[model samples]
Target: MKSITQLENKKVLVLGLAKSGEAAARLLAKLGAIVTVNDGKAFEENPSAQSLLEEGVKVVCGGHPLELLDENFELMVKNPGIRYDNPMVARALEKEIPVWTEVELAYLVSEAPIIGITGSNGKTTTTTMIADVLNHGGKSGVLSGNIGFPASEVAQSVTNQDTLVMELSSFQLMGIESFHPHIAVITNLMPTHIDYHGSFEEYVAAKWNIQNEMTSDDFIILNFNQDLAKELATQTNAQVVPFSTVEKVDGAYLENGGLYFKGELLMHADELGVPGSHNVENALATIAVAKLSGVSNQAIKETLSSFGGVKHRLQFVDTIDDVKFYNDSKSTNILATQKALSGFDNSKVILIAGGLDRGNEFDELIPDITGLKKMVILGESAPRVKRAADKAGVTYLDAKDVADATRIAFEQASAGDVVLLSPANASWDMYKNFEVRGDEFITTVERLKG
Candidate 1:
């Protein structure tokens, strides 16, 4: 790994003591940087900040004071969730101080080749699949970033022999300066996180940041079906490899029920354990990354057939009374929910949806719900989603929460029906994150089954 000596004695400010923030602060301290951490949560409530304080780092809690900016820190490692609009962040930018995310620090010290994947959907599935493919091929592949493990923590342990496969979000990408991945994959870009980015154009631009530092020697896998992704080919110096579900291309393509790479059949599309054509796209991207990483076709096929998919993503919870229940709580956007619904035959589905609104109009989701047998709405966006369901002429019921939604859906569903929990909105209004939201749905389903 590269030595972090450059950061030694540099004054660094860490904002927000989230997972990434904690790791960055600890790493900075280890590198002998004067690390001062500021978190909005009080010291008693912020365990991460408390840990840093025990290590002799300066910990400021309860709020982000403007005085912190006057400390003349050389750099600020702000949490990805802390937007540029934050007063401190804006002030830091005004003072010409570099504001970075934890990923930037990880990249600066990491010795391993990195494979970064980003998109509005299917990033987790594709990132996990790529790591699995490499591992099956007898290579050490470390998974991190937005998938759970902080990239900063993963980078510390990875060596030149290992491959760091990261699931990057646009939020994480925005904070990167020189963070470049050897192999970058953009599964597909959609208008998402409008709440954070303030516009669709800005969101798309953030996802494109994955390739910002790539050179010709690097490789970028793009989705042929997404024009926005395809248009990015000219913007990067990296070699572009496109994967398509519609037509054959020079890269990976799905034709005649088989996945083909550069005109050679790799595996039958049906052999893939994950459902949905979106997953086919995810698999194709994984295949491209595996092949580029020197993994054998056999290993790729083996991983594809065995990889059931990541949790909270079209995960099959259980079948009680012959009704199949699926937890897709990770579908925190309109397009994701549409993709989830497309996986099953429309008429056999009873969908449970609604969550943090994010000001997204559900009118676009109307057509996707046309085939649903029933719809159960809950959380903050229930009223908005209910209006869309009404517009689509789909029968829907109102519920107070996921538990209520699950009970109502199960009651409305019959044998041979699918009860799907695919909230098109985020869980921030009702729960901690999508994982917690999904777990609650699973717990509720299991209780009913018992």
Candidate 2:
């Protein structure tokens, strides 16, 4: 394990004072790193910022001045909320100072092996599934990420023999220099976080950085069904293993209602606790990582058999009037929402969408909304969503909040209808983050039941 004592007296600049950023700053300060926490937003005006300062963190809020960063620093750790093009980051690059994401910083001190998962969609599900598989494989101390926990925070508390699985965002990948994973994953790429990266290509580049930095000694797992993932494999030097749900895969596949790895049957479909075709793909990635990690077949089956679905990825809440309410607030991208839409047979679905604009175009799903009964728009991006829904000639309405949207959808719903909260944009304009946004939606729907 890397010694925390080695970072003593090291001058570290921690960017953005969110949970990950604040966690990084606190840990660094405890390790004796002279940490200065900075946020592009204001401290007095933002409660989150104010809390960080109240906790005794040296804070530079309401935008960072480049002059404040001119001095030599050992390292800069940034939150996933900070994109690569931020002015401070550009300046940091010019100065040739090492910059890392919270995940990278956590790994530097973790004795546990990293199992990284990234994709435009399904990252959270895949990460959780992989962690479950590792735990079932009899590897104790299984954590999502050590020190930098979104779900991975448990990694820091576990023993070295434990396995660590990380759901990495592109923002996290952007700042890494030499961070490598023992088992890396690309669930499948699609357009996401386009507003931050300025373009889809740039976003893809940041995601590809994870595999690009790995050597042949490290293994890469990807979905063969993703054409772009196949193309990306050719560009990287790592050994590529592929998995698919719709067809036969070289590394893993689904057959006869069961999941198989290279002709080796690992699990029955009824054994897996997760549903949807995407979950099947997630299972494959988990099994492949398990195989490479020397996990036994029986262990993999046992782990998968008892695993439950993630919080906001197509989570089933309750059925009211035969209408299934699914909380997929975690699907903050058009591609992710599209995947959620694909999970069920199109009959009557009320898709509650709209949030902070993330440079996304909704035209891709317009032609495919044949079964969409209605669409409700809410939050900062409501106007944009209404515009797209109007163009598609679909029934659309603007709601004040998630509750309003749910109520409207309920009034318009029929038996066997599906109420889906899959906002294809960030939640910052109206809420603290996606988790809050999702919780609000779930609470609203449950209230309707009463």
Candidate 3:
């Protein structure tokens, strides 16, 4: 493990006061680094900044001042959510100062071999599944990173014997200098977060950064079903292990209703508790990770069969009057929503979609609207989605928000139909995040049940 002493006496600037930034600042201070934290949120609004000030660390709140860069800081730890276009970040680049994310700090200090998972969708489910399978197999797995808990928090106590399973976002991956994972898995690649990265190519490059420091000794599990992932195989130095739900591959594949590893049966595909064909791909990726980690088939099977799924990703909410409600608030992109829709019988589905406009066109989703009983649209991108629905010759209605959308969907849904809240865009337009949007949907559904 890289020594934390490397940070001692180093001048470090942490941008943003979010969870990752706060964790990083505290950790850096604890490691004896001279840390300065800059956040756009005011000091009074950020208790984290106040707490850091008490620790004798410098706190610059309310906004990122360009003058702060004059401090001649040796390194900068940036929150993944902060775009590279930030003035301070641009200045840092101009000065040739190294900018790193909390993920990099976590990697430098962590003693365990990290298993980083990234992709447009299924990251949470795949990460959770890997950890569960490893734990069941007698190997301890500590979950962290984009799964909510900052990796810096988990890195402090992680041992070499333990496996650190992380769900990494493209934003986090973009800032890494040497954050290498022993087992890296990209479930699948699709156009996502274009606004953040500025373009599809840049977004793809950011996701590919996960393998930048990996060696041949490392394993990169990819989706063989995805052509982009297959193309990525040629670019990585790590051992490429492909998983597929389509046809048999060298690594993992689904055959005759069974999941197989190198032609050996691991478990029955139907036995997996998670619904959807997309999840089968997730399972395949997780199975590869489990097998590589020395997890036994029995443990893998047990975890797969018992694991209901991660919250907010096609989670079954309830059934009212024979109509089922599903919460897929985690579907924050068109590709994700399309996959969610593909999970159900189109004729029996009433879809609630639309959210923050990420400058993404909904044309790709037009064809998938086939057989959808109805579409309830809302948020910033509702009009764009409605246009696509119109082109598909599908019926739709606009609601003011998720609550109104839920009510409309429930009213429209008939017995035996499924009400799916799978907004094909981010939740920033109306809700704090996808979780809040999902909780509101779930609460609304429960009220309907009452």
For model 1, residues 314-432, the per-residue Cα lDDT tens digits are 87666676577889999999999988875554556899999997887899998788647899999888889989998877899989889999999999987557899999999999999
List candidate 2 stretches off by more than 4 Å: 4-8, 40-57, 145-155, 309-450
lDDT of each residue in 1-450, candidate 3, tens digit only: 446688889999999866678789988988889999998878875666888999898999998889999999999999887789988999999999999999998998999999999998778778878888899899999988876568987798899999999989898998898898999999888887787898989999999999999999999999988888888899989999999888789999999899999989988988998767878988899999999999999999999988765569887676676577889999999899888875555656889999998887799998677557899999998889989988876799889998999999988988557899999899999999999999999889879978
Q: Which stretches of candidate 1 lie over 4 Å from their true place?
A: 309-450
| TM-scores for every candidate against the unseen true structure | 0.72, 0.66, 0.72
What TM-score does model 1 achieve against the real structure? 0.72
Q: Write the per-residue lDDT of candidate 2 for residues 54-120, one digit (tens) a residue.
A: 7766788888888978767778887766667788877887888788877766676677777788887
Pairs of colliding residues, candidate 1: none
As for candidate 3, its clashing pairs are none
Error of 1 at 96 (Å): 1.1
